[model samples]
Target: MKQNIYNFFLMKYSREKIALLISGKASFIALFSLIIIFSFLADKFFSLSNLTNILDLSAILLLTSTAMTFILMLGSIDLSVEGIAGLTGVVGALMVKNFSNSNDYGLLSIIICILLGAIFGLLNGIIFTKLKIPSFMTTLGLGAVASGVCILSTRGYPVIITDQTIRGLAHIKLLGGVIPLLFVIAITINLLIWFVSERTILGRHVIAIGGDEAIAKDLGIKINLVKIMVFAISGAIFGLAGMLLVAKLGAGDIRNPYGLLFDSIAAPLIGGIAITGGIGKIPHAAIGAITLTILRNGMVLLGINPYIQQSVVGTIIILTVAITIERKKIGVIK
Candidate 1:
């Protein structure tokens, strides 16, 4: 007994739980470690200019991942981010930059685009919960539908920016610094997500529903309403992402980084959101997003091929899930 007790504290697994909670998922520790390592291997990787550049790059993924964190927390997943964001971006760009040059409504256009995204969320929820269809297949099918809308809207053409007001967001500096307004918007959205996930009754319901539907129902929670609301929330955020993307890139290319849904999910999973649902926090995935953006951006500067980048991301995702997922929570892998 004495030997066993001593060995437990001396063992590597003892600090594992604490580390997992503090900074494990999304390899937060590894990100910092790499920051130090790369500061030496590569020039100016840690310089203020380069660091600001990394933050700017991370904002988009963080925005998407934060919304994704909500969906995953409910033990649900939305694979439709790419299509939704793409649609939102194209719509917003066209609304503000029509060839007639009469489409400018400024910030109101942002609000309308966001609401449109929420409509998609509502559609996903109603189709899944009301129709009694599984969300997995529902989102997959809707993704295709949304993608088709993108094709029809742009006809495969990218929307260019003539609106100086919208373009200013992408180029303007905060306090005369390199920190674009884009990162600020992304971070603000994430702060709101943290509030919703941590402070409200609906947030509690989301956690409960994800953890166990039967149990949540037994507790008299409005399981269906909560589930539906989350999908809408995810959609609304994606809508904001669309507007932001257009502002950031000054164009709405149908085939743009709109296909980043995989990385969005991968970020949350790596940050320790259980695939089974009801088991993770929004902030965790946000951190994971930054970590991933760091890794990818670093890889780019290091001249790594983009194809191999996906492979590396895939490996990290598998390993993160293997280490962090509570497999017993899931009854079957299928």
Candidate 2:
């Protein structure tokens, strides 16, 4: 009887693994299909310039997604990306380089602003873990506070960035257009994140904590500290992303990119990261971010109805998560 039960469980586990493999393979197929559709519909979608445009976008979204994966892996949802990105972008614009005769702040000012974001994340983690508040509510409240700070700091106006060092990212290619320094920076950050997630004692502890917090604590893991570290890492990366956007756009609007949180969620979800946590990879989320940016860029080049883009992306996110999520882990999705 014992042997029969063990055999039955092994077969069930193998079947689930097969399903996961198929879903993981589908995301790549979706990327290829999106590309083919664009080429067939849009004459200029395959141009070299358009390809670079896609890479530029992938740079920012990838950073945001990479940050969120850490939080998601811990079975937590963080809506703080929007406010952190917006505020930090605003702060960096106001304080980095030269800004419309308003002020002249150097890279040191930028560093200070980045550190502030990390502080915000740290506060959030404390509230969520120590206070025993639900992660969702804690992050939502903290995100609002960050947004309020944005309004107060900028006084409801856009700040223009005019520093050559910062603007270098958006313009000027070295090695005669064969390579871009901006892309190098973005890819470097992603690889560093991958290394931490794949090869550190702390990283393994984090995964173990996410797998089962109760068991992890019984095994002598410092659960609170790991959770706090995850949020801090997220905030710091988002600070970098905000700075990148300022360099890219050359201006920081108070209402810029009003809905970054959705993209943050979508990228990881589409990349095969589990919403229920403990099973996603950081590098995989970058793949999803690039795939998403390609879809958006292709649609614009193809002149698909501008309004249709949001709905299409929303639909894709839902479908991808449905196919990729481990249903057994989340028996009751309310």
Candidate 3:
């Protein structure tokens, strides 16, 4: 019995398990370490109000990053998030009782925005799979189109959302105002994605396809269907994030999602998700978003220049990608 227990402990600490542990917790470890450092350095960094602000800001990025995780898991990329988000925000606002429109669709506007996002995503999938377009180029073009649509819808003007109920939802708080309702909603969405990724056959297929698309195709997996569904789901999430952003800001501007594309891409990449694909968790992306939010918030508190902060984030992305990406799998750097 003693020998068996010792052997079990040894196996638990084996190289494979050790590597898995490191890979799984690397982002989390970095997050906590940064928190500690910032707490010691900035006088107000660890305050409850500041922490709540971080969580609130993290909610939007968390939603977008979660969506991106699905596409990344399939060894594909979605550059259309910002554009889709901007389009949905403008459309949703216009449909609701807002400054620019007399129509009052209420909850239906939200549904329509999400559906619009899904449609665009489906189109992306169809173009990529049927037309044989590279995902990067296809998504980039689609993004541009979506941004154009947003601009046309607003005529280069911002639309103020005056619906009290929608704005109230954004301001709602729980746990003595330490947690925003929007953040709670974002967390719930993340949990659902995690469940799907971990428990469903569709999720397994995504990983298998990412691991080896040729083998997955040969094995009778419906590659096009899966890719399309993933993109649609991602687009819907992006739409929801956009709607939430509108509520938070009380306006729908064409430029609302301008900087989100890079942040969404960076979060998953920093969270140990392979750029080559096939290895990552949904929760990892959320943690990465939180880590980034904390970093940015701490920097602001410490009086760091915003441009310098962007440079630091860019540097971190380069370093993390270099270390975490599966270089052995790709024969060529390009």
Candidate whose TM-score is highest: 3
TM-scores vs. true structure, each candidate: 0.90, 0.89, 0.93
lDDT against true structure, model 2:
0.76
Quick one: best lDDT, which candidate? 3
TM-score (C-alpha) between model 2 and the true structure? 0.89
The lDDT of each candidate is: 0.78, 0.76, 0.84
- Worst 10 contiguous positions by lDDT, candidate 3: 5-14
For 166-189, candidate 3 gives per-residue lDDT tens digits of 778789989988999989998898
The best-first sequence of candidates by lDDT reads: 3, 1, 2
For candidate 2, give the lDDT of residue 326: 63
* Comparing 1 and 3 on lDDT, the stronger one: 3
After TM-score superposition, the amount by which residue 187's alpha carbon in candidate 1 deviates from its true location, in angstroms, is: 1.0
Model 2 residue runs over 4 Å out of place are: 1-20, 99-102, 172-175
Sort by TM-score, top down from the best: 3, 1, 2
The reply for model 1, stretches above 4 Å from the true place, is 1-26
Q: Is candidate 2 or candidate 3 better by lDDT?
A: 3
